[model samples]
Structures are given as structure tokens and as C-alpha cells.
Target chain A: MSAKPPASIDALIELLAKLPGLGPRSARRAVLHLVARRSQLLHPLAEAMTEVAATARECLNCGNIATGDLCPICLDDRRATGQICVVEDVADLWAMERGGAFGGRYHVLGGTLSALDAVGPEDLGLPRLADRIETEQVTEVILALGATVDGQTTAHYISDMLDGRTRVTSLAKGVPVGGELDYLDDGTIAAALAARTRL
Target chain B: MSAKPPASIDALIELLAKLPGLGPRSARRAVLHLVARRSQLLHPLAEAMTEVAATARECLNCGNIATGDLCPICLDDRRATGQICVVEDVADLWAMERGGAFGGRYHVLGGTLSALDAVGPEDLGLPRLADRIETEQVTEVILALGATVDGQTTAHYISDMLDGRTRVTSLAKGVPVGGELDYLDDGTIAAALAARTRL
Candidate 1:
């Protein structure tokens, strides 16, 4: 598509290239495929993206993507539990929801506290989280942030901010389910051994 | 992404997943990324797709994608050099254009002749191509179709259809440029040896 893709087609390729997994080459292939199925796929996909762009927004309460002021989880009355699950992003919230456990509300930090990158508590919406804990009468704040150094540092910061006003806990660190011992890293094996309990 | 993406967002994800290289998980990530930059990416991409869908059509003369009755190549006067390069698809035509070696017009076959798939000469626009050869006073037809069995079969079918009306040639097969001899496959090595030229 070097010398002769039209301007509009080239623009489409450039935008598609900005997507997470697609590059210039794959974007061109995808665009060609889309143009080939203009009536069925391309038109519909465009319409859908337009609709989503117009309607989608972040939930006022949890930072999850929502069509309205609140996300589906926040809008559901049954989910107004005394506990709040703290996650770094909407993706993590979705993962927790898929587990079918944790009958609680969620607070999305937007990102973890990163001193090196200059990400701070204010940037992560920690003040809003504090307000939620106070107003919602929350009992537990379950931290499902990833097991990275930045994640743990953020978790500790949040714990200190709460100051025992509510219980602060985090997801257990151990061998993952279906993980073989031989393939498991040393740190994970140690964590699994340390966190061991009788079934 | 699993449990609670908005309906419109989910639809966008589903459509994105149907693209050539994107999967469901990558589609979800892309959707999130798009929503995060709705103004910069999502809306613009949607608009571009809509515009392309409304304007793009196949060139009436050949089968190349075009926004008008004829593609840019067909509209260009300088490309009418009495030489028509036949290709399997628009991508192949683009490849040729990128090489900047051929100044002649192009004929996109859309796909190779496949008896098993019931794809015949008419479906590949061979009759239109024949008409073009006569009308354009073509002195040569260069077959740049791939070296696949179906590609060769299509080339042979076109050759027989012309029946020596003009000179017909297929792309030479051998080790590609920048390809090392030791890494070359047996068939490619054999072809290279058989078609060796005086350098």
C-alpha cells in the first residue's frame, strides 16, 4: 500500500495503527479486510465505535467505563455492600467480577502510586476513596492491585491514609492455581509455603 | 472486560475481534485504549471508516479498490503503456507499486482461479481483462500472481484464454533478494539454479 492507497484509506491505516496490538502492516491488512466487508463489518463497526465514543464515560463513583453517571456495578442496588474492592483499573474490576466472589463495591485508583514516574495519591483519586469509605460505611478495603513493587507501595499508602478507620487487606501472594512446582519461581514457592494452610 | 462492559462497548469489542489479527482479549484492551482517548482516536477512526465505506468501490476497469469509477492508477494517463500487470489482489498491486519498477497499468484478478472453490475465470474478471488487452492494444501481459498451485493454474488459464494474442510472462521463481543460499529451501534453490542468469 505504498504508492497508491488513497488519502482516506491511508488515514484509516494510520489510526488503526495506533491501536494496542496492531502495527502499520497489520493495520493495513485489517483495513483491507474491513473495506472488503464494507457492508457487513466495516459500516457496522464504524457505527458501533461512533455510538461508544458518544455514550461511553467513566463512572463517577468507581472510574469504570459507563454509559451514564455510574457503571453497571455501581448502579446495581444489590452491590451496595459494606466492603470496597480497590483495583488499579477497570480491567482489574472486571476480572474480580468474573470471579463471582467479592460481593462489594469497587474503587478504581486509575493507576498505582509511582514515585519514579511522579504518580501520587491525588492523581490516583485517593481522596475520593477516603470519602467513599466514610460515606458508604465500608468495613473492608480489599486491595487487588498487582504484586509489583509500585502496587504494594500504593497499597501501603492507602492503608496508612485509612488509619484503621476500616480494615485493609490485599490479595494473597502464592502459587497460582494449576501452577506446577517445578515451573514455579522461587519467590512464589516461598510465598506459597509461607501462606500454607490445611485444606 | 468479561462481566460488565457496556453494551455498545461490547459490540465494538466483538467487531474488533473479527478483524484479521485482533483477538477477543486484544479487542478488549483496544476498546479500553480507544475509550480512554475518545476524542483523539475513537471518534476520528469511526469517521474515517464511515467516509471510506461511503466512497470506496472497485475500479470498473480493473478490480482494484477505488473511490471513483476508476482507481488512481486507471485514471493516470502515463500508466497506459500497452503493458498490463495481472495480480491476485489489490495488496499485490500495492506491492508492485512500492517496487516502483512497473509503469504499466494493473489488472487485479481479486483472487486466483480455484476449481475446488468453484471460482472460475469470470469471477476473477478474466473476460474484462481480455477486453482490456484488446481495447488498450496491450503488447505484453505480466503475470505477477504468487507461485502457489492455484496462482500458476490461474496464470495458465489466462495464457490459454489469450492463446498467444500477445506476449505473456510470469514472475521468475528463485531465492528472494537478500536471501542466503544456505537458508534457501530445496525448491527455491532448484528454481534459482534452473533460472540462473549471467551476472
Candidate 2:
């Protein structure tokens, strides 16, 4: 609006605009929606935010978000399968969890080693990962990082770093589970063909 | 994640997903962002939301949101131009304010008369609007509702109801200020030609 809204409402809109996928226009709409449905949406959301702000914390063991020192997965005794899946971020770890196939624990690297950004292995908890292999009796490590150059570089570096200590494996290079061959990119098609499996 | 997050965090994401533009995926991303930047974004946002949730209220006179009984526009002596702008929702009022064109007070209808939804004049505060026209000594009433059929029907209903009480006006129909002629629909082209003004 040409006229600025009340200070509190304006502040809410500005903060909402900073969210990842929401811009100024959508943020304004969101603010209006919240204001219109105050009891049902806005007030409850505010309470939830306050609660989460006070309690949410990062897991000390694997970098996953938790309400306590260690994440739930790391705390579970049954999940101590002598294997660790390494990912670039907590979001990636969550994606892997959604697949429901991995029985081992996860190590969130926080980010990949970015040469341009000056991010190194140390910045991504690689050192901590090494410590976990021995401490947690990990016998295998799965690299579930992206297919980007940095991801590959990070994977190779970790493999070399842990050489002769544990079995290192990676997600297969193939078409996605529900992917149609015609819709795939050239690199994906080539990779799928190169890594074709026997029936 | 396969494992549920802490209850508070899960609740926050669910509430965020109910917003206008955000879906479950984006809500998760937004929550992750807030958690990652707790001090900078999350805490401040939560505080702002709490403040707005406590103070924000509907204007008794015009149905616009305000922190007090009367909205800022209704309280301002400078905006007493004896002209009232009628809009379907508070969002439209804010949009008009952003344009900085109108100099009169606003009357938010909250919604239009929707027969399918069993909405009627009283449902949209039309009676209160009529009372305001007489009490505020309004000279002109501008209908700035949408171009949809319901919006037009609402505008016509209001105009007829106030036929003798005040002068009535609708926004002009023409190509938008910067709109290209070729890209416009045929109806818009016809309206623009029919309402053409002398150069």
C-alpha cells in the first residue's frame, strides 16, 4: 500500500518477505490472510513460532535439528547399524529419511566444500565424521551428496580420507524411480546406460 | 524427515503451510530457514507476530484492520473528502493506498454478495455502508471492486441503493497505463475504444 500499515503489521510483512520462497507481494497477501483469520491461523502460528524458537536446537552428533543435544536417529540404539550416510545439509538428510530405505544414521555435512566460497572439509564437519566412524563403530559410509562437481569432489575426498578403514559406496547413477526415459537429460541417460543393471 | 521433528517445530511447519502461498514443502524450507537463523530472523519474526496478533483489530467504522476502534484513515481529519471508496476486501483497499491516487476514506465490504455461497448485503456490511454515506456527508461513492460478475453485481446493487443519496462512479475501462494493445483481450480492446477520450 502507498500508505504504510501499522508498524507491527508492517514489521510482520517485512519479516515474512524474507522467507525463502515468499516475495513482497506474496508476503503482503500472507499477512492479510493471517490478519483475517487471526484466531485460527495467526495467533496459533505466533504461539508455535515462540515455542519452536525457545526449544529447537541442532543435534550435537549428526547436525540434524533436535530439541536436545543429540538427534532422535542418533539416540536410537536400534539405528546403530555400523553405517553412516553423509549429506550436504539437514534438508538432504530429511529427503533420505523420507525414502525410508536407509537403516543407518546420517551425518549432515552442513554444506559441501566450496572452493569459491573458501569452504573446506573442516567447515563441513568432515573431521567430526571421521571421529564418528571409530567412535560409533561405523563399518560402511554412504555418500548421498548431489551430483555436482563440488559434491563429487567432496565424495572423492571423503573416500580417500577414510581409505582402507570402511567400505565406501554411493547412490547409483540411474533414472529416477518414476522417471520416463524420454524426459531425462543427456547426462542422466548416459549415466543410466553406463550403470545398467542385470535382470 | 521420516522421523517427526520436535512437536513444536512440526506444529510451526503445519501452521506455515496453511498460509496463502506456502505449501508443505515451502513451509518446511521456511521453518528450516527460521531455525537456522534463529537470532536474526526467527526470534524477531516470532516477536513481531505476537505483537501484531495482540494489537491488530477490525476498524469499527470501516472494517479496515487497525490497532484501535477506528482505522487510521477513518481517524485522520485530512482524509475527510466527503468521498468514500468501496472495496471488496482490505487487500484491495491496501492496493488502492499503494497507488496513492485516492484521497478519501475506505469502506471495506469484507466480501462480495455470492449467491452460490448464500452471501447477501447484510453479510458484507452494506447496511453499515449506507449509514456511513448519510452520517459522513459523502458526496461521491467510488466502486473499486473486481471485474468479476459478482463484483459488478455488488457494485450495481450499491449504486442503486444509493441512487438519490449520493453521486456514484466506477473506475474507467481502458488499456492499463503501460499495457500493450496487441496482448489485450478483445473485450478489453472494445472497452478501451468505447471509452476513448479526446487527446
Candidate 3:
């Protein structure tokens, strides 16, 4: 009731509260937790944050976050240059990487084109994709973007852009691997039926 | 996933995942968010952590977290020395302070006496509390400890220890404000009934 917290402690709470899911209450709890274990958590967290702040940067080639100008995927020469998988965000890229199936590189679009937000082809780095296809000799471009209206519109635009040059393919729309037929949505069941493969 | 995150990035995620409420998945999302907003969030947070790491420490007298040897409460001379409020932890002290009802000094016990965990009066600074009662000429000692078994056990021990020196009062048990009688446990309903006052 008497003396307020140190100014820096309040500032720390404010910054933490700005994170994706944390609010003021959770931020205070986290700050208290960190202070209670200063040596174990506070010190290491500070060092780690300083390290990331100084080194983290967007990859020059594909917009993925990396310490260097090139992200890990962009730096890996072993990955196939003939195929490029496109996704709407770096989280999508990380998810595809976790699957460990595709051996190709990725192109992070940052976000889909939204007229309301004024995002356009240039913002999505469409010209960069065009240049990459020619320079990397990419024969196939895989669209791993979501099935939203914006995603479908972007996929169609990309397909038309590379109509005569390289093959463009979108991921199949069907019931998920463990999806139950009874739980499947109408659109999903209809799409699965249209694209059904014979056993 | 293809090329694992840089060492610093992975370490940052691991450290964040260790926080009370955050999990590995949420940690990843938070790290990504911080990295994406390095200038706005990462740098300031790092600076704030470094500041707290260097300055945060426990009050030698009261065991409350403080920047100096004495906590703010101890430093403020206007507070009444006639009463002392004892709490189980710093978080509890903060909660009391937020309530703004107490104008007396505080003594943080760190924890309660627990025979199972081998904790005793010495561990909770009971000796120091006895010294404070005599030194500060305290007339009343308030026990704001929770209603848990350990809390009650500790309260009884303190009440007996200060039997002749000063008045010791534990917080009254009753149904919480805004709590519905229908939703309250039998014990809380009973306590509320027993503590009932004239309207």
C-alpha cells in the first residue's frame, strides 16, 4: 500500500503484457515468478533476450527470421532448388518443416493480399518469387497456404502469374488424416468426395 | 524444423517455457512475436530484465523484495509501529498492499511451519518477529495467513508464542464477497453464519 514497485519492474510487466496471450494479471504473475528465481530465470531470460535482440533478423531471401541474412532453410544447399513451397507466415513454414517430408525450400509471404488492409502483390514479394523461379530453376511451386478466401485468391493469382513457366499446385482439400466422417463439415465432405481416390 | 532455430532462439524459447503459465507451444508463439517486434518489445524487455536482475533483492529486515537493504514499508516512518501484519509470501504482501487497508508495517515469513516438509518457526523468521514486537512496541499482530491447514497451524503457534507480549488476531473466515451461498462450501457457509452481524 505504501511504496510502489521499482519503475523497472513495472516496465518489465508492461512489456510482458504486450505479448500475444499475456495480460496485466498474467504479466504480474510472470514478473513475480522471475523475481523469486532471479538467478535461475531472470538472468538467463535477460541474456537470451539481449542475444535475440542483437542477432535476430528477417532472412533476406525468404523473409524467415534468422540471425544471419539467410535463414537456416535458405542457407541449406542440400534442399531441392527445383521446388518451392509457399506459405502465408513463418509459423506455417515451421509447421511444414516439422512434418519433415518436403525437401524443398519455402517462401514466406508474411500475409495474404487484403484490399481492406491495402496489402498487395508487392507486399507479398510476388516479384521475388518470379525472380526465384527463374534463377533457382524451380519447376514446381507448392501452395501450402490456408483454404480461406484470401488464400484461394492468392493461389489463383500465383497460378495465373506462372501459367506458362512453372507448374503451380495447391494442397488438396479433404478430410484431415484423423477426421471422422460424421464430424466433417459440409464443404470438407463435398471436396473429399470430388477428389476421392480409388482404393 | 529443417535447420533448427539458432542456439540463442531455442534457449530463449526454453527459458520462456519455464515460466509459470506458459507452455512450450505458447513459448514458441511468444518468441516469434518478440522476434517479429524486436525494436518495440525485445530491446525494452531485455533492458528491463537487466535492470531488475542487477537491483532486485530481498529486504534484510522484512524478507520482502526490495532494491535496498530495507523495503519501502520499513523505510517509511509514518507507518504505525503499534501493529504488524505478517504474511506467508511476498505475493501475499503485494496483495495486501493492493487492498490498501493496512497502514501498519509488514513481516514476510517466506513460508509457514510444515512438519512434513521439515519447516519450523526459525525458517519463517519467528524469532525476528518477536524482536520486532518488543523493538517497535507493537500492540497487535495481525495474521493474514490463508485458511489452509499449514496456515492455521502456523497461526496457532504464533498466537501461543506471543500470548503475553501482544494481542494476536487471525483473519476471520467467512463466505467471500460476491460469493453465492449456494456455491459456497459447507464450511464457508457455516463460518459466514457464525460471524453474522446485525443489519
lDDT of 2 by residue, B43-144 (tens): 999999999999999999999989999989999988989999999998899889989999999899998999999999999999999999889999999999
User: DockQ for each of the predicted structures, in order?
Assistant: 0.63, 0.67, 0.70
Model 2: residues with Cα > 4 Å off, grouped in runs: none
Chain A agreement with the truth for model 1, given as TM-score: 0.96
Residue B2, model 3, lDDT: 64
| Ranking of candidates on TM-score, top first | 1, 2, 3
How would you encode candidate 3's per-residue C-alpha lDDT over A47-92 as one tens digit per residue?
9999999999989888888999998888888885689999998788
Q: What's model 1's overall lDDT?
A: 0.89
lDDT of each: 0.89, 0.92, 0.90
lDDT of 1 by residue, B57-146 (tens): 888998788899999888888888999999998888888988999999899998888879999988998999999988999999999999
CAPRI grade, predicted model 1: medium
TM-score of each candidate? 0.97, 0.96, 0.95
lDDT score of residue A62 within candidate 3: 85
**Model 3 Cα lDDT, one tens digit per residue, B148-174:** 999999999999999999999978898
List residue ranges in candidate 3 displaced over 4 A: none
**What does fnat come to for each candidate?**
0.69, 0.73, 0.68
In model 3, how large is the Cα lDDT of residue B182?
86
Clashes of each: 0, 3, 1
- TM-score, prediction 1: 0.97
